[model samples]
Target: MVIVFSFRKDPNALSPVNCWHLILSQCRQESRDHGALSEIYSNNITLRLSHINEDVARLSKKSKEIGVQMQEELLKVTGELQT
Candidate 1:
């Protein structure tokens, strides 16, 4: 989902880049923001994303293990019911 926000500009509060940045920032990912532009590298992004994928894979394996165990218990209960 996308979010839209409106903020009033205060000339004294922030520098032009910072002020405008706050308003414009909500429109897109912060990765496109000025600070990230210089410091963020493609390889850094790939490494972080790979870590996220690894976490997802680990969670998926755990979920499958729990599901299989539950199915086995249900089958045992069904066998008792049949006898």
Candidate 2:
């Protein structure tokens, strides 16, 4: 792909070499942009995973606390029924 830059006053158009340079420049810029976007996406995913892990840990702790409480209540009720 190439672009011909010409004007009415200027008879000279863009050379093929210049066109290739422009194309390569645009390609390099696009590659950099893609790399930056990929990095941002990866960071976001890592952050979200960290948050999820923290939430899971918190829920697990709460579940254990509830389990202990239930066991205590059951023991108390059993003792009352025996007496």
Candidate 3:
């Protein structure tokens, strides 16, 4: 199974979170079906699946941080406009 995820910068709101969820879900499913934690580690694949999993986790965390920052900026701008 192959899934592609794209991220776009949204000035008004956070980017889609579902992409990360989809990737994580797919990784879990593949791990279960293959009966191994690191299949790409042993095989010649485009990228090491194990490393991809780690990258996904890191990206997810960064996305959350970016979302929070965007929300804060929006709130600040709204407050300034109100005053």
Best-matching candidate per TM-score: 2
Model 2: colliding residue pairs = none
The TM-scores, one per candidate, come to 0.51, 0.55, 0.45
Q: Please list the C-alpha lDDT of all candidates, in the order they appear.
A: 0.85, 0.93, 0.81
TM-score of 2: 0.55
Backbone clashes (count) for model 1: 0
Measured by lDDT, the strongest candidate is 2
lDDT by residue for model 2 (1-83), tens:
89997757533667787789889999999999999999988999889999999999999999999999999999999999999
- Please give the distance, in angstroms, between residue 39's alpha carbon in candidate 2 and its true position after superposition: 1.2
Of candidate 1, the 10-residue stretch with the lowest lDDT total is: 34-43
Candidate 3 residue lDDT tens string, 1-83: 99988877676663467667778899999878786635654674545676798999999999999999999999999999999
Cα deviation at 68, candidate 3, in Å, is: 0.3
Residue pairs in candidate 1 whose N, alpha carbon or C atoms collide under 3 angstroms: none
Over 4 Å off in model 1, which ranges? 1-39
Per-residue CA lDDT of candidate 1, range 5-39, in tens?
98888767888788788878775666567567556
Rank by TM-score, highest first. Answer: 2, 1, 3
Candidate 1 displacement at residue 65 in angstroms: 0.9
